[model samples]
Target: MLQDLEAKALAGDAEAQALVHLLRLLRRKAYQEARAYAEGFPGELRERLLAGLSLLEEAPDRLEDPLFAAEREVLLGVRAVGEGRREEAEARFQRALALDPYHHRALTNLGNLYLERGEVEAALDLYQRALKLAPDDPLVHENLAALYRKKGDLDRMVAHLKRATRLKMRPPVSLDPLTGKPKRSFRIPLWVWVSLLALLAYLFLKKP
Candidate 1:
């Protein structure tokens, strides 16, 4: 489960950070906040996330298909961003959304670009729209939470974080700077899983 969550996180699951945030809150005995966060997940968005995970994971397989023109454009946009071609990247992302209004990842990357430029309102708009299009997307949720946090809105931040935590609540790992490998595996014993589940129920369901 740990490995699975790490794979999803490293693959850019936005909500991966939410799980990390939840764990941090839990460790700090911020039970009220954690519960508040988790309660938000029992909604339409949770259903979407549960349903769409497989589709997102398999999406890259279609990159080579002719029908995935918009997806290809998103990749180009991402590459452009990495190359520091800001204008080009923005244009590529915009072109992708023009081709497919529901292009989830493209919206996310574009939102991120806006956020980096300190365009909070534009970034928020894009991120919210992105979440609506891909509610189960971890990265979108995480980004939204970050935006909220930046705005000093802890409640909203925790709400989105909870949504992300529901996606893959596993211990995060640190990479070895030299080898680019995980420094340690979060190997939990079966008994711990059972106990953890019980604790989760208490933490999330027992009203604060």
Candidate 2:
């Protein structure tokens, strides 16, 4: 069945190609999906799928494809940041940004690294850049709010917190109330709950 689908996909059938690409993504075989779609898809769909694949941090091998090399470089930068190699990570991120200025992951990671290193201004700049590129990224709003809080800019922090809260709570038009269903409610990460509790505690303490 799968082989038949692949054959059909390779025969310029867009729907089959899209299905194959989706299956590959679900299997976590993103690089292969990108390669297949790049090889089989016509033009715009191919470009979009390849771009989506490049965003996956796991697809380093896909860097060999010229279209994805810049994304791969950004992923390497993020890896360096994770390993505590700040300078190398920053350099790599800069290179990636030079190649694609609106790379959201690279911008966010660079902002976070700068924040960690106490370069608050630089971090804010990077976060702003990221926001321009990916306005709906909750993490970016969260981080920016954190920065403003640390800087004692209460008004800006509160504004950003409101934006983050709205962003976090926007729901799909329909949701599944049952478990083991095709549609389900999004799970809030544990850290968000923890932060909420902390905020409540601070408010309670201040009420006295």
Candidate 3:
């Protein structure tokens, strides 16, 4: 859908062109430019672009899209952390979370902050909330494991470590929570699998 928007924008659609610009700004690190563009969205332009965004809301998690303010603040917080400005980073993440309680990255980063400060209980709560929202994230699993270890919860630590290992050993998969089954991927045609297995068996039998 975004690809289609790009095509339309390139072909002289004014609304698509504006929306493409907004998306570009969203992805960029230029806070001033992005904010200015967002603030200046005139009535018609704003509605049209919002409609375009709604058109792209095809994912199961679309309802919780992060606000632009929350996204920018989280981005700044992430950069600050990389620069070792721990205090500023914590403030930024906190502000982002204040604006959007369900901002997953902000929660995870702030949890890291607490964990670094030896606030085991706070960090564990944030990590658990984050993991609840993003259960399949291996890095989050590792972080949660470390948080558990900080509090001497060996069982939980081992569980998260095992989950992280399992995720690492497999191709990306999403489990259906209701049934605890992995969602199937696009399958190879059966003939291709059979031929590959036959070739592998022949080579194995030929080996010493």
Against the hidden reference, what TM-scores do the models get? 0.50, 0.56, 0.52
Per-residue lDDT of model 2, residues 70-98, tens digit only:
56677778778788888998898787677
Name the candidate, 1 or 2, with the larger TM-score value. Answer: 2
* Higher-scoring candidate on lDDT, 1 or 2: 2
The per-model lDDT (C-alpha) reads 0.67, 0.69, 0.69
Per-residue error (Å), model 1, residue 155: 1.1
Which candidate number would show the highest TM-score if scored against the true structure? Answer: 2
Candidate 3 accuracy as lDDT? 0.69
Cα lDDT of model 1 by residue, 1-208, tens digit? 3345456768887566454444333323234454445444557644543333323235533454332445557767877899899899899889877766766788889999999999999999999898887786678889999999888999999999998988657554454423233577668899999999999999899886
TM-score, candidate number 3: 0.52
**Candidate 2 wrongly placed segments (more than 4 Å):** 1-40, 43-62, 172-208
Quote model 2's TM-score.
0.56
Model 1, position 49: C-alpha lDDT score: 34
Rank order by TM-score, top first?
2, 3, 1
**Highest lDDT scorer:** 3
